[model samples]
Target: MVTNGTYERGDLFDPNCGTRLILDRIGDKWTALAVLRLQHGPLRFTELRDGIGSVAPKVLTQTLRRLERDGLLTREVFAEVPPRVVYDLTPMGRSLIGPLTAVSDWAEEHINAITTAQGQYDAGS
Candidate 1:
């Protein structure tokens, strides 16, 4: 498809492949946070921005776009005075429950120890 006289490869480990494309979508700074924010229920754009703490508006918009493009979140636009928009997880996104829950529980259980380790590492550095 190019001057290199080569076609695209489908292998994920190829470094220039499409298989890791999914990771590129959801493995960023804000996609997971957006998903976690939407887990409770649907939220407006402003609410989502506030829920995720200090993320900038531009970053949040980009994150939401990536999630929507990947079919993980649904965005609804309402016809109203201010044209409200809401974000919610698709069923596919909800399917992430088990893994997220497991990770959350594990984090809760060992947070103290993790904090101690971080403190030690910080002191060393």
Candidate 2:
């Protein structure tokens, strides 16, 4: 726990803290993609799978479950002739969009430079 004049925050850097667990969730590539896809609006399971192409169904399911467990997203199930499920971001998840967008923008902006550096490192190795 963090103690200050008037504010308190979780100690993210602590080895045993939940912060690292949280990071493990959002730091995942699939999680990032899923979050971004849901930013536009809610989508069904198939829609999410199709949008996040090449992801195994099981992996996607696990990712969705993890996000929901963390309270980052909501899963709604509807009863019909055929069962239907949809996923959407929660307020906490929506709050992440801007930061993730900034990260995406930065990656796009620096991709070329990063690739060049990778090439140089690979050549030297």
Candidate 3:
């Protein structure tokens, strides 16, 4: 439903809704981390890899490609001696920071309780 080029709100509860795919992308651990890492500014491939911890080079490349395809981020290549490339978040991607931050904070706040619950459940099994 488009009214004068503006799309109406999507119904996420609908199985066919594309919003679920967007949700899945944002819910991904790598995606969330990558987005958070770019919150400060752009970073090079190696920098992103190091900042993201244990992500493999191949995996990171794929993730970056997917993010680029989804319009969440941009990858720019510079014509340098060694050919430098940088990744930066787009406006849409920056919008995710607040929501991701909230989720991250909630996880940090409840991790101990979650661990305790998991342990209790395991012991009872």
Candidate 2, residues 1-125, lDDT tens digits: the string is 43464234567887766567778888899999999999999999999999989999999999999999989999999997699999999999999899889999999999999999999999999
Candidate 3 lDDT by residue in tens digits, 12-106: 79776666778888998999999999999999999999999999899989989999999999999999989999999999999999999999999
> Rank order by TM-score, top first?
3, 2, 1
Model 1, residue 3: C-alpha shift (Å): 22
Please name the candidate that would achieve the greatest lDDT relative to the true structure: 3
Q: Residues 1-125, candidate 1, lDDT per residue (tens digit)?
A: 12366455566777766547766765564876788778899999999998889999998998888788878999999999999999999999887656666766888999999999999999999
True-structure Cα RMSD, model 2:
3.4
Stretches > 4 Å off in candidate 3: 1-8
* Better-scoring candidate (TM-score), 1 or 2: 2
**Cα RMSDs, all models:** 4.5, 3.4, 2.1
